[model samples]
Target: MRQLLKFELYKIYRQKSIYILFGVLMLIISLGLYMDRESEQANYLVYKQWEGEITADKLAYLDKEIIEIEKKMESGIETPQERLLYGISESFAYQLGNAHKHEKRIADLTAIINTDSTSYKERAAELEKNMLSKINMSKFYYDAGPAQIIDMIYTFGFVITAFLIIIGIAPILSNEYSSGMDQFLLSSKYGRSKAITSKIIASVIFTLSVITGWVALNTAVSVYTYGFHGWKAPLQSMFQHYFAPYPITLGEAYPIMISMHLLAALGFTLIVICVSAICKRGLLSLLVSGFIFGVPFAIDVVFEDLENIVWLNKLLKLSIYQCMKVKEQFVDFSTYNVFGFPVLYPVVTVLLSVITAIIFSYLTKWIMKRKQVTI
Candidate 1:
């Protein structure tokens, strides 16, 4: 097993694809850092301009808005739909209160309100209600200008790492068959079982090494660019338009987020490897893996607004994003209630993805044993 693992590692090292993937990941991180630097400078300029004039006045005005919205909602004249709409609007408004003065709070708020066509009076009322709810719900008001950009970069790493792992492992079994190496190995004394185990182990090691490399690169870039001060802030608080029912500081949420992300990457890589083993063609495996991963994203981009399609939403929800928690960074809000426990979205997502990967891998092994190789 160790010998096989070493051979696998050597193969990975010799592959130019590995270095190319690493270079791509580094390029992405560098671009993200550059963008974050520019964003920070811009944010600092805005902060200096609004240092006093806007800060105090904005907070006070937010407080008044919250009070007014609560007062109106307490009147109990609104329907459940109205109340829900109010809630959504309020969440956005609260984010605005915490937003830096130069963050285009008013324009964003107006855009949210204008998204739906309603009577002028209704629009005005909805805007007011939303503003208040947002102010009241906002638990943190710190600038995330550069930090957010960094998180986005890390999030993209999830995709890149998974892609690289597939590229690395997809050819492991397939190339052996294509090059007639499988017949030589299979003809050996321990060929059937031990050889397969060794291949599986090697694939796993290669996948994990790639994952680790990406994570290490992301960590180095993040620490260098953003420092590590606010990692404890609630992951939920980083969102701009949605609010968690319970306040969570980034300090409280980041560790779990990171853990879930790692699990997701592992699970996704395992599934891709299994696909490669079954297909036994690198290009074909790559295409299949890409489809399995990319189709969900394509659906999300095209049909995200069709909220009435509950089944579609559920299906898309099961996509790679669910496993990787990538959507958490983009979506403003997510509800979590399972068996009366307030499960975090990322935890549930990783759990489900890992479970699916295990099932698929076992099935792949079974199928491989049953199918007779022609060579």
Candidate 2:
């Protein structure tokens, strides 16, 4: 089993396309770093002065300073330092305003609960519970570094990882057929079980490596540029996720998102491997994998209003796009009604990813076992 796993890994390592794709990833990272060079340093220095627990006094000071800066700007005598200070103050004030929005959201949900509709009441109660978790956790910090990393991972980084997984693993099984090696493997006593398991394991390693590589490079550059100042900060500190319902800090959310991404990638790997086994042609497997992966993203993009339909929204939210870009799961208060219990979307996504991987692993094994040599 060990020998077979090593051999399978070696075959994946030998794929020149994998190396080329990795090179592309590195180049993109380099270009991104160059484009954003020193652009955020002033923010970092300014935020450092304000880092710590946010107080009413700090808020008042920011408001007063912002008004004064505006007056100076109106007079056409505002200096660059004052301009930077105004931007920083606005960022802080805007992020802090989400707390008021969150309060209003909770109150709206409460009003619904006051009414007499049981179904709407239950749903509103669940959503209120989710929103309440984030109530007092919002605090000010220099969170740009972690925010950029989280955004990058959930947005562009996962796209690259997905393509790498598809390009690398889609051919794992099909190549064996293309080279006429499937005959001996299927006819061997241990081939159906051990060899197939080893291939799956190798694909898992490859998927993990690809995720880790991109995450590490991205984080290294982001932290180096942004000064790694906000790991302990609340998720609400970032304007993009100011209303995020997760109670966890950025430090906690980062690993959870990565784990979610890994599980999603693993499920995707099994799917590509299954396609490879069934298609028995490397190029055909790649095309099929691309279609399977791209269709969900395209559908979600085309139908923005699907979120208004409860059932369609749930189904689409669980699609591969949501799985890979896991931030959407945490950015809002969404719940799934499971057997009269309310489960969070992140929990449901994790469960679905694991279930997909298990089911596909067995399905791929069954398909491989039923294969027969053809003339």
Candidate 3:
């Protein structure tokens, strides 16, 4: 088994296409980082001066400074220094304004729960619970880097991993059959079980490696751009997560988000392997796997405005796209009613991924065994 696994890993990693895809991915990431226009250094310095617990005294001082800056701007002579200060002031005010915005979000959800049909009442209640939990979020910190990294993981990272898996791992089993190696393999002593088992394990390792690679690159680039600050900042300090109900800091949420993404990607890799086994042709397997993986994203783009249609929207939320784009599961506060109790979307997504992996594992084994017998 160990020998077979080693050979499988070698075959996977030896492919030039894998390295090429990684090169492309890295180039795109570098381009994105280079093109970013924000003066993160200046922003960081300004935010650092006001970091920590946001208190009334700080707000008052900021209000006075903002008023003074506005008066300077109102005078027909404004210097670049004044403009920069004004921009910083407004940014701080906007960050603080998120508190009021979050409160309004909670009140809106509460009102919907009170007036909506009983069918949606449970979901609304869950949203209310989540919102209320973070209602007291008062701390502020320089979290721009962490926020960008988190957002990049859910958006670009998942897409990159999916394509890499398709280009690399999707051909694992199908190429064996295509090249007529299946006959010799099936006739070997350990081929029927150990060889195929090794392939499955190898697929998982490749998936995780791809995910880890992108995650590390994202973190390094973001940290280099924005500095290693805000690990202790509350998750809500990020504009994207202003409504997030979790009480954890960016340091805590980072692991949870990556873990969820890893599980989802593993589950997806298994399904792609299963398809590769069934199709018996490399290109066909790639096409089918891509379709299955991409359909959810297409649906989301088409029906984005129909989220008010609860059933359809909830069904879409269960798709792999939602699992891959995992940030929404945290920020949006969605839930599933299981056995008359509300289960958060993140929990449900994790459970679904695990279940998919288990089911597909057996199915892949069964398919391989049946194919061997026929051959």
Candidate 4:
């Protein structure tokens, strides 16, 4: 079993296509980081200009500054500096409001996660304790700027990771059949159970390595360009348009994205493996898996505003696209309740990924048990 697993790993390493995918991933990361580095420093310029203007560290000073600016505007005479002050003040006010909302959202979600019992009385007691355990999240004054989180996470990370996984693992079993190696392997001792088992383990290891490489490169570059200053600040503080009430910082959000995306990638890899196991030709397996993975994205683009076709629209949220959209899903205000618990949108994706993985595990086992290699 160990030798078979090593051989599988050796085969993957020997594949030039796998090496080429790694090169492409590095190239994309290099280009993205280079392009964004110069523009990233500009956000800091504005932030520093006003940094010395205000002496206080609290949000109250910013509020007072806003009132003073409004008074000056009322006189129908304003200076450039006053306008800048107003803009900065409002930005601070927005962050303060976002932080407060996030704290409340955290408390609510905490209560939801803490309740394990189905009894109404136990749930009621926990709810009261939750209200009393409210955390005071006020001092969130940081101008670390937008982390370019979506671009790094989805465009450069998730897409590339998924493409490589499909390339690397889609041929795990199909390639054996395509090259007529399956017949010999199945006829040999320990081939039926041990060899197949080794392939499954190898597939998992290969998939995880791809995901980890993508995520690590993206994260290292992003933090290098942006710095790790606002990691503990509110997610909204970094992206003004992002108003998700998730009580989490960029620091907290980073690991969550990694975990969720990892599960999602594993789920996709397993289904592709299942397809590869079933199909006669490796190319046909790739096509079928590609179609299954792509149909949701196509629907999302073609019928994004499709309110009437709600069920069809939801198909978009159930696939790789949803996994790629880690940030949006986390912050989405949509509440899905299962047995009275308020499950977040991002969590729904995670759960679906796990469920899909389990389902395909059984399917793959059944296929292997009934395995045949036709000449």
Best by lDDT: 2
Q: lDDT for model 1, on a 0 to 1 scale?
A: 0.58
Each model's backbone clash number: 13, 0, 0, 0
Instruction: Report lDDT (Cα) of residue 108, candidate 3.
Output: 77
User: Order the candidates by TM-score, highest first — what do you get?
Assistant: 2, 3, 4, 1
Please identify model 4 stretches exceeding 4 Å from their true place: 35-90, 97-137, 141-146, 149-151, 238-241, 306-308, 373-375
The root-mean-square deviation over C-alpha atoms between each candidate and the true structure, in angstroms, is 12.5, 2.4, 3.2, 5.7
List the global CA lDDT of all models: 0.58, 0.81, 0.79, 0.68
Q: Report the poorest 10 consecutive residues by lDDT, candidate 2.
A: 129-138
Model 4 scores a TM of 0.76
Work out candidate 2's RMSD over C-alphas: 2.4
Residues 160-211 of candidate 4 have per-residue lDDT tens digits of 7777777787778889888988797677587677777777788889988887
Which candidate wins on TM-score?
2
**Residue-wise C-alpha lDDT for candidate 2, range 280-316, written one tens digit per residue:** 7999999999998898778777887876787877777
Cα lDDT tens digits, model 3, 223-263, are: 88888888887777676776667667888888899899888
Q: TM-scores across all candidates?
A: 0.67, 0.91, 0.88, 0.76
Q: Which stretches of candidate 3 lie over 4 Å from their true place?
A: 35-39, 71-88, 101-127, 134-136, 308-311, 373-375
lDDT of 4 at 69: 80
Better of 1 and 4 by lDDT: 4
